[model samples]
Target: GQAASSLGSDGSGYGLAKALKHSVTCIVPALVQLKVKAHPFAKASGVRTEAKVTALIDGKEAASDTGEVQITAYGISGIPVFQISRFIALGLHQKKRSEVLLDLLPEYSEDEVYRLLVKMGDKRDDLTAKGWLTGIFNQKLVPRILEMAGVRIQTRVSELRKSQLQAVAKKCKRIILPIQDTNGFENAQVCAGGVRTKEVCPRTMESLRTKGVYITGELLDVDGICGGFNLQWAWATGCIAGKASVMRKKK
Candidate 1:
């Protein structure tokens, strides 16, 4: 009788009603705040400058003397030309120099690439010579690569001789675009240059110069091509630094 009566009681029903009301009241305002913050720059244009960054780590003094800074729409701040901010930060902490060299294209051999283009032309005689490259490369990139190779887009594929094909292929693959400079710190998500890896222990990420100083993340002279490789490197180095720090504390 008591169990049956409890099911019909208003007390239990009131408690459930109160819980639901409280949940919605708390959740709705929080959601509204998040949405407002997420679109802070919905109407904003251009870049915002950030405060000058300077730090001292492990007895090393590092500063952004250029006083240059920039922030992105997502609230992330960095410099454009120095995309290696993470590495710079790490180096400053470890008292090391930060430097980076970027090679725009690392995969292709110039001579071999040229040969492939030459072969493509010979193989596809029926297609418009200029349009023959549509299968091998993006339409947008075809013209650029051809220009670098000194090949005319209008030339018939059938007209391409072995030597010409070789030249085109070489240019497509070995188009050397030198990195004059990287986007500075404001636009850069991480620093390309940092403490030399040779001086730091890869296993632990501990600095050789200072026993208690641990270097990790973008601070080391290791970079991966675009996509998530840089973030992966950070995660890996962070783990190594954390473990090493723990080990040092244990001793």
Candidate 2:
């Protein structure tokens, strides 16, 4: 805000524009990843796997994606996590709580997971509960799953009660972890908030609030996800603003 306003972007000349208080109109962690206060039972050193990730704000789904979620000691990364980071960043900016729900077994329904567990229980009663799941789910995930379900890792599957199996099934399908914040602006590939787009002319990229001033690219309140959308934005807006400014000079 300071950087743009310093260049007279705060509508200094337009009597129609008042000197306004600055606030984030959208987000800051666009194309970045989220940081989390991962549950102790859900912590992983550096594991990578595919899952259906849902980011929530105040218990409502704000964003979701299905892909690789890289679990670090601190929190999650990878593209799927990046896809939802903007929502989390915005939620945090508004002082609202955010969360992430991971479906490690995206292909299976909750009931199907329970049935599979029962079938495995019938055949692998001799193996420990953790061992039984190790063959089915990722070995790296068994400990965390069992831990999340409140089951002891070494308990024999034969010793497992019906309720415990149900609990385990639920955890596998929906492991919800609270998000603390984003990885911060330094880690963002591109940012989302700047000059308000409503204050600029769409055709010319000139500031409606202050004539002859053009705001474009990351300088405006626009951003995009991965795969060069942001790159295209920068180029297109720069061209429009540049051309308009030149045409005005000729006039």
The numbered model that scores best in TM-score is 2
For each candidate in the order shown, give its overall lDDT on alpha carbons: 0.44, 0.77
Predicted candidate 2 versus true structure: per-residue lDDT over 20-110, tens digit per residue = 3222255456656666684553456577888999989999999899988888777888888888878888888888879999998899999
What's the distance in Å from true for residue 27, model 2? 4.9
Q: Where does the lowest 10-residue lDDT sum fall in candidate 1? A: 26-35
lDDT, candidate 1, residue 56? 25
lDDT of 1 at 209: 60
Question: After superposition, which runs of candidate 2 have C-alpha atoms over 4 Å from their true positions?
Answer: 1-27, 41-43
